[model samples]
Target chain A: AQKVTQAQTEISVVEKEDVTLDCVYETRDTTYYLFWYKQPPSGELVFLIRRNSFDEQNEISGRYSWNFQKSTSSFNFTITASQVVDSAVYFCALTPPIYNQGGKLIFGQGTELSVKP
Target chain B: EPEVTQTPSHQVTQMGQEVILRCVPISNHLYFYWYRQILGQKVEFLVSFYNNEISEKSEIFDDQFSVERPDGSNFTLKIRSTKLEDSAMYFCASSVTGIYNEQFFGPGTRLTVL
Candidate 1:
């Protein structure tokens, strides 16, 4: 079984401040995938990033970045110079690689982020 | 950009009634999935379908639930009998080939079982 945990239930920050949301996962499989998704107030999930376990390299996409640490079993997402649009519920998901069966996404409880101007 | 689409943005049904939710996955995608989220709760996986059959399903997907790719484009989820606990936002997603493929989700159908 694969499980993902996002410790922070809620976070608030002023616009332009940087924020990092924490995520930890547990999986016995040697190969797996980690993902970050954003659900805005409209209640639509938007895919953010996907990182395979083999690739520990950190990734940066415009204002968004992700750090994948295998030793700690953590995949954290950070937003730089956050704006009001960044206020949304962020979820971390895990997928086991052994079973190439239908792509199943085990999601976390999600972190609700609020950015104030 | 290509994306998945679901029908009936909101549906209100009485208890014990049957309901079917529809989805049109991306034209070129092969894998399809259904997930639901109750108010203030984490998203839960229900079922996954591929190659015109069910490939995997969660414990939550019991005999009461069924999925089918009726035609070339549509995928549908049917619930035998509605329950209050089933009232939630149901999402349909699709991905390309591999298990690691990033799934694209629809806006979701809000099912309200009365």
Candidate 2:
């Protein structure tokens, strides 16, 4: 069984503050994929990032950054200088390699972030 | 950028009634999928379709659920009987290729079973 865990159910941060959302996953497969998705109040899921198992490098995209650590089985997301617009629900998900399965994503419970101005 | 689209943004049906949720994937995409999210819950994958047939399905997808691509552009999920527990937001997604490709998601349809 594969599982993703987002322990922080909710986080409140003032504008310009840096916040980190933690994600932990469990999977027996050696090759798999990890993802981060954002669901705004509009109810549509917006894809944020995808990290495969073999890559341990930290990725940064503008205000967002992801740290993938295989040793701890953790993939943490950080928002630098978070603004009010960053308020939304963030989900961390895991999936097997394409050939292993039908690309089914097993998602975390989700962390709801509230960026207050 | 071409995006996936779904119809009937919101649908309310009584228990035991049948409902069909429709989606139009990106024109060149080859894989289609259906997922659902109950209120305040994580999204769960239901099924994935490719080559005009179901390639994968979760336990949540049982005999009551069926998927079809009746036309070239349209993919549909039909629920033979609705239950109160069936109320959730259904999302349709598509990917150009299944390997290491990110799937584009639709706005989703909220189904309310009364």
* Residue pairs of candidate 1 with colliding backbone atoms: none
Per-residue lDDT tens digits for candidate 2, residues A13-90, read 999999999999998878999999999989899999999899999999999999999999999999999999999999
Q: What lDDT score is found at residue A5 in candidate 1?
A: 97
Task: After superposing candidate 1 on the true structure, give the runs of residues whose Cα lies further than 4 Å from its correct spot.
Answer: none
Q: Where is model 1 chain A poorest over a 10-residue stretch in terms of lDDT?
A: A95-104
Whole-model Cα lDDT of every candidate shown, in order: 0.94, 0.94
Compared with the true structure, model 2 gives a TM-score of 0.98
Worst 10 residues of 2 chain A by lDDT: A96-105
lDDT of 1 by residue, B1-114 (tens): 898999999999999999999999999999999999998878999988988889889999999999999999999999999999999999999999748589999999999999
Provide DockQ values for all models, in the order shown: 0.81, 0.71
Candidate 1 versus the native: TM-score? 0.98
| Model 1 lDDT per residue over A4-74, tens place | 99999999999999999999999998989999999999998999999989999999999999999999999
